[model samples]
Target: MDFEYLLQLILNGLFVGSFYGLVALGYSMVYGIIKLLNFAHGDIYMLGAFSGYTLLTIGAGVIGGQASIAVLVVIMLIAMVLTGTVGLILERVAYRPLRGAPRLSVLITAVGASFALEYGIAVSFGPNPRVYPVRLGNEAFTIFGARLTYAQLAMMLIAVALMIGLDQAVRRTRSGRAMRAISQDPKACLLMGINVDSVITRTFFIGSALAGAAGVMSGAYYGKIDFLMGFIIGLKAFTAAVIGGIGNLRGAVLGAIVLGLLESFGTAWLGSEWRDVFAFGFLILFLTVRPTGLLGERVTERV
Candidate 1:
């Protein structure tokens, strides 16, 4: 391929990968703390997009014309808060009660929760896709012969900012320390006077909030929202988290970028039809060859 074509592919990969990373962060965080896959997590992203669409639709009636950046930011924050609450409720209702039950039970509950969210939205919103009220304009600028859009740039920057903020929160704060402690040994943390339940709830909140933010950005960029939109993205995010070492935060981001690039290049070589196949194939290969993931440390299980 030519330099410009290659550059465009790279940019596309980065743009899509940023959102994947955001969604993957939620997967990694929840699994790290509770060891639950939380299959419904992607629906939380779908809900977020819907939530942002609702808020913006209301705002459009009041403000009229194109929305200002401040208004869009406000809508995004509202969506994050709304989705985060939904995630908290999901954990409390679906997962927490089964904490001491068999892992298989919890896993099944996760699938059930996913179905509930998907069909619930379908029933409430109808099966038709809704157009996002505000579409971020695809005003393009050329960078080294590769076309770049303002919307894509904005989404990428926002995703990066959120990822960095999450990384800092997990590494720098007292809550971060509590989270780490609980992940290492929940019972020991409780014995040490740490509020394990509260920390876990906070983790869900943060992770879901990130997913929500990604949802809104995606809606704006893509200009359409549907109940089923999260299914593929969710699976892709899970693959990313697994590739990065399921419980590793930074690894999720790295794996997402790598996966995105792979998809971009794969689509260029094969067709778009093979994108999912390519991504899943990599997941299987990674599982077989380096299950610990690129950044994950290998651990020996004790009998």
Candidate 2:
């Protein structure tokens, strides 16, 4: 009911939603291309955060503890490359061989892969939450009684820019064309001389890269990273993908924004404990009412 508070929540929702969109894009892309859920996608995000954390920690000694803008950018880029490579390998090792297997089998494999990544990191990192060496200090500016941090603005800008870049790539690039073609009919694409496998592999890489970027930004923003942190967020991202229309790039972003706003307002109304309930409730409602989502068409769709 308070207008200023409502505006603040909106800004927060958009910021949160942008990151969700990043992760959800990975889900939607893999699903759209190979029809694999790639539940392990979230774990790749976890790894991204860890990768950045590790790099930053190594640089901490050199940078004297506080990471500058240049250092953070370099670390984020490195983490994205690492995470993208991991996604590429994951597709080859875990999902590619089972490409023709039953949907249930692939689904099970995805879940298994998810578990493997989650606990593997736990084992390696000892399961304790790692404090990110990179920190965006709490400098902020208020707008009409709503406080917005410069860090938040910078992060949101980067996320949105990445999302826009992806949308453009999907729309205007040769690889994007290949991806869409493969998505529609891989068999036909194979017949038409398109390398389906390559396209799908690249999809995973790009999606995972975006997710990795999100993970780094999130770690920097929130100031903590952990192995299992990706699990719930992964589920939420999937919900966003489904809500946005799995194969539709813009839809995924839109869905995430919707989910973020819903959670922001729902938490405002109900409480933090009820946040997940409200978020997932939208998933169920959308599934029952409009399975294809706001932008998904009944006709064959492309990623």
Candidate 3:
């Protein structure tokens, strides 16, 4: 095997893994806070991509049909806000009322919400894949014969930055403290004057926003947006969370990177057609073995 080709695959894995990590953060956060699997979370990411598509379409004329990184950033911010609001509203409408209900009921409700979001977009968007307005050029540079696109590099930097910022905020901020406290014990947090429901609402919002930003970034990079696009990535992200130990923020990221590499190597070994098969097979095997995951289920570090 050529060493340069191996390095290229690694780079590709990291790129895709970063996207998985962003979406996985949402899954981990929601699970950490409320122990909800939040099946609808993936559709929130789909919403973000569509929202960015809408904004880009509307603003394209205003910007004279030219899109720059700055323009994409603005669109991404707007999409995040939109998706965050959707998450907050979803929490209020779908999940909050069932707070004390049976876990199975809540899980069913989550599945219902996922279907609602998916078909809602399909009905609105005509079930057709929408092409994004912005498409990054394939301009690239090479290091030791491993190619790196300017767009990939920029997007990776942004993803890493967002991940780091979230980690810092969770560790250092007042809201972060409240989140951790509520995660530990909602009743105790309420006793301590921490608004448990409020923190949870904010958690859903922030987590959804991260997923949204990822959606927009991915849409811009790939140049296509479809209603069902989130389904596979969502599963992969969940696998990543499970692999790294769900509810552990850093663990989710680490798991995503590892999964990415696994997929990359698996694809090379078995071809693209067998890639998903290989990855999902590994997931089943991993769960049957070490269910606690790489970092273990972390209580204090869940956020």
- Model 2 — TM-score against the truth? 0.97
Q: How many residue pairs collide in each prediction?
A: 0, 0, 0
C-alpha lDDT score of every prediction, in listed order: 0.90, 0.89, 0.89
Among residues 3 or more apart in sequence or in different chains, the pairs in candidate 2 whose N, CA or C atoms overlap within 3 Å are none
Q: Model 1 Cα displacement at 272 (Å)?
A: 1.1
| Residue-level error in angstroms, candidate 1, position 151 | 1.1
- What TM-score goes with each of the models? 0.97, 0.97, 0.96
Q: Worst lDDT window (10 residues) for model 1?
A: 294-303
lDDT of 2 by residue, 34-118 (tens): 8778888888889899999888888788876667666777888999999999999988998999988888899999999999988
Pick by TM-score: 1 or 3, better one: 1
Candidate 2's C-alpha runs over 4 A off are 299-303
Candidate 3 per-residue C-alpha lDDT over 148-229 given as tens digits, one digit per residue, 9 for 90 to 100: 9988998889889989999999999999988877767888898998889889999999999999999999999999999998
TM-score of 1: 0.97
lDDT of 1 at 19: 94
Instruction: Output the worst ten-in-a-row residue range by lDDT, candidate 3.
Output: 294-303
lDDT of 1 at 108: 99
Off by over 4 Å in 3: 64-66, 298-303
